[model samples]
Structures are given as C-alpha cells and as structure tokens.
Target: MTSPITTLTLDGLETVYDRLAQAIDRAGEDKRALFLVKLALLNAQALGDAELFQQQMEKALLNL
Candidate 1:
C-alpha cells in the first residue's frame, strides 16, 4: 500500500517572509532592535542557529 502525499505551499511562506522582511526594513533604528531580535529568532529556527538567535535576543534586550 502507498501512503498519501502531503503538499506544502511556497507562496504562503514567501508572503509571510516578505512581510517580515518589509517590517524589519520599515522599523526605525531605535525600534529595530526588538524587530531584529524577533527576526533573528525566526531565522534561527528556520536555519538551525540557536546561538545566533540567542545572541540577537541578548543584544536587543541590552539595547532596550
């Protein structure tokens, strides 16, 4: 017997990523620290870089 195949949506993922990137770009430098931290966390999860994500979070917190 063959198992069912699941499909993923690239368009939706692209849309979300684009929005996040745009948000990061639009944020002011002072406000960007937090935004960057959040982006870094997401990037870490997506790219498997926990250390970098944690570093970004710490930097953001320090800036705050």
Candidate 2:
C-alpha cells in the first residue's frame, strides 16, 4: 500500500518576509538576523517541512 502525500502553502509569506527583512536590515544586528532565521526554521518544523526549514534558513541569511 502507498501512503498519501500532503502539501503546504504559505500564502503571502513572501511579502511579509520581505517587509520583516527590511526591518531587520534597519535594525542592523547580525545576532537578530540569526535568531529571526531560527524562528522561521522552528515555524517550518511545526509545519513538518524540514526541507523548507533549511531553505528558509538560508533565504533568511541572504541579506545578512
């Protein structure tokens, strides 16, 4: 037997992320950037997508 597959969609997350990134940039703290990325990854884990967690972590670090 085969199991079912589940998909995840985060509508409007990009826009929110962009705005938050802008704020982080303004704050100008490397540690803050790291923690924000950690927070995002933790949320991703709650959503059950480890791959997305990693991707978001990297993406969060991009501007830093």
Task: Evaluate all candidate structures by whole-model CA lDDT and list the values in order.
Answer: 0.71, 0.68
- Candidate 2 structure lDDT: 0.68
Candidate 2 lDDT by residue in tens digits, 1-64:
2234455356576777788788777667867867676766676657676675677669867979
Model 1 lDDT per residue over 1-64, tens place:
2333344499987998798778978997788999876866676666565565577568868946
- Best model number under TM-score: 1
- On the 0 to 100 scale, the lDDT of residue 37 in model 2 is 66
Q: Could you tell me which 10 consecutive residues in candidate 1 have the lowest summed lDDT?
A: 1-10
Instruction: Assess every candidate by TM-score.
Output: 0.38, 0.36
C-alpha positional error of residue 39 in candidate 2 after TM-score superposition, expressed in Å: 2.4
Off by over 4 Å in 1: 1-8, 36-64
